[model samples]
Target: MNRAFNRKRDKTWMHTPEALAKHYIPYNAKFLGNTEVEAPKGTEVVEDAVRKLKFQRHIKKSEGQKVPKVELQISIYGVKILDPKTKDVHHNCQLHRISFCADDKTDKRIFTFICKDSESNKHLCYVFDSEKCAEEITLTIGQAFDLAYKKFLESGGKDVETRKQIGTLQRRIQELETENSELKKQLQDFEEQLMMVHGSPAGSISIQTQSTDVFDMVPFSPVTPLVPTQANNASPPPPPTTLPPDISKDLFGAEPFDPFTCASADFPPDIQSKLDEMQEGFKMGLTLEGTIFSLDPLDERC
Candidate 1:
């Protein structure tokens, strides 16, 4: 039978009448501490009131930070199940996983459990202040144990898969090694063939020669010297002389027209008008300055 409810306030249990009678809520459900029950011995209390407090309650505040909170935690009858190493491993080899919302909108309480042996899997246990989380904790622990057990069964043995992978890798290595050995043998045979074909395997050979005149081999004492042909002798070239070129006429013919004295009428009408106006203004300004200096009454020296 499964336990299900909102562990915060809606504290309901999902179980048959027979299952509810058999399963008992412990008198002391406190984690890392002890508790006592005040109810009658056979009373049907759905839960124990003992709660798990924060680690800060036992810590001392030195300087600005809270120092380590120490506790004398004993697993009662088992080994030191509460490991100080801070790792998530629980009593069983399975991991200890817990989740909780610490906000004011939701009841801030944690629920946690671990997978026990298959014989004890029927009873899912948890520690939580909120009744909603407590019911959720029971169902979650049962599902976790079922899933973990299935995974454990699937990954139990290592012989078949491991051996197959090792055999495949070994075959591939052997194939590469065999191909390398065959190539080395072929290279050795080719080297031997080359040595047999070449005369000197270490170095090449050299052929030397000595020159001699052809007259020594023939009897040519009666032969006279032949007459020289016209092609045998060539005439010398004439000597070089320094001479100046005639300047009677220009080499480029007539000189080019002077661009400075060229007519401004060849330009566009607007450009010509601008140039003519500038020249006329200069002449008028010079005449006005000359007349002003000559006829000024303030110029006594003129």
Candidate 2:
């Protein structure tokens, strides 16, 4: 368990000084811009976007060379010019052209840095007074500028990606709105068809609708009958009779009937007796005063 705990990785390893150099280079610079002016100087530049070039001229207490000035500002995109005494900034953001060469022109050892002026358009030169380390100072400044410019370009790429996401969302919203309209149209068509059915001849019952009816639907509803439409046009039924021949075919406008068998069509004696007794009660001024009786047609109900 102890070994496993000891093997935990360092999450902050990337923030270490050595690891940080991959994204940024931190270098202290010296100023030797004027070869004729002799002064003891301590110089360093530090910042997030643009590094300030600070110069503290070393001289006797009575000398004018003992001045603290911050005049040049450097970043990845371009350089800025400033007032040395007042420290006021000047010029556009893209203000300077920077390149380097050896002071000896070919020595490659005694390095010199050069930058073009924004207003003058002429080049200014500088070199660290230290004989052995001037080359290191010149090379470090060049690399720092490169990294800053790369970051600026990456920021622009993020803006383009955000615009693309916005455009995609707008198109999706339009599609949803169009689909909602089509659904509303389909619902309207279904309501109209329902209204037509209620007003047809099949639905014979009259329904009174109110002005405040919800969704324009019918106010009253009636149940439909199970009988077919042909029943309405049929003739009235015939009176009950005790004849052998079937007379129903004429009453209902049907074809004349033929006998089912070559014999007399008659009820059983017991059935006929019950039917006659029921009929005699009608003569006694009663609609019916008899026992139960039933009669079925040969093929269908009467």
Candidate 3:
């Protein structure tokens, strides 16, 4: 019956629900101290509050039980970890004074941090089981101090003046950008005008594209026929043509009027006949070539 009762009691486990609960918020190490005492040196790394190599001392004491308590606290910057090394509660630690010591390779898993104590101003050393964790924590602390110092100024605050100068430069750059945009627009308008004036006559305006290849185009202009010009050293103009005997006034009638006003018996009748025939033919040719006939009046089909 006792064995059955013991089995039943063991089956009914306590704090099962508590063990399964999830802790989203981070917690600190349970304790940090020498491992000689039968107590926890620090909280488990899984419960670390900061995502860095950190530890916190936790003393587990029950009600009506007396146990010496260990005190631990972090300063404002959160880098200074306050853990007293001596009995007088002195020699606190700051992250800035800490460095990863390059000791001889004794153990690959273990590393040390040499830090200066705040109270005694003497260097204190601490060893860790994880070399990677030590290096990471040391690098983080060094970067933190660097960032803090870079942010610090004469006024014990942020460097606002440098920020203001940067803002001014940014505004100047924006103004320059606006000006550049305006310039580009003007250039585009000029290109369009050029296309209208010069490109249309040559051919369709082949606008240049954003490419490294080059295309050459000829400009166009209207051409006028050349006029003949007389050179300066040309010969003088020919004399005006002599006036022929006035025929329109009919000074000489159909009867020949000789300047001698006398008829010559020596003139041959055949020559006179030939001259009359030639005159008649010349007059007929003039009439045929110079005169226009109205063909419509003579057209019987009309």
**Highest lDDT model number:** 2
- Top-TM-score structure, candidate number: 2
In order, candidate lDDTs are: 0.29, 0.34, 0.32
Candidate 3 lDDT, tens digit per residue, 1-302? 22212322243422222221221111121122321111111222112221122232222232433323233332212233323344343234443343223211343443333454445544444434443343333333333332322233222222233333444565675565566556656666765665565344544533333222234322232562122222334443332233333332232333322322232222245654433433322222110011211112132110
Lowest lDDT block of 10, candidate 2:
285-294
Q: What are the models' TM-scores?
A: 0.21, 0.25, 0.23
Q: Judging by lDDT, tell me the better candidate of 1 and 3.
A: 3
What TM-score would candidate 1 get against the native? 0.21
Name the weakest run of 10 consecutive residues (lDDT summed) in model 1: 286-295
For residue 223, what is the lDDT in candidate 2? 67
RMSD of every prediction: 43.5, 43.0, 51.3
Q: 1-302 in candidate 2: lDDT tens per residue?
A: 22111211122221233322344322232343332112111111111001112132333324655332334444444444455557576432231134332223233333444444445645444443334544443333333333332343354422333434444554675565556556556666755555455434543423433343455533443663322222233443322222232233332445443332332333455654433432332122100011111111121111
Please rank every candidate by TM-score, starting with the best: 2, 3, 1
Can you tell me which runs of candidate 2 are displaced by over 4 Å? 1-30, 34-96, 101-109, 155-302
Backbone clashes (count) for model 1: 6
Q: In model 1, which runs have C-alpha deviations exceeding 4 angstroms?
A: 1-53, 57-110, 113-129, 132-139, 148-302
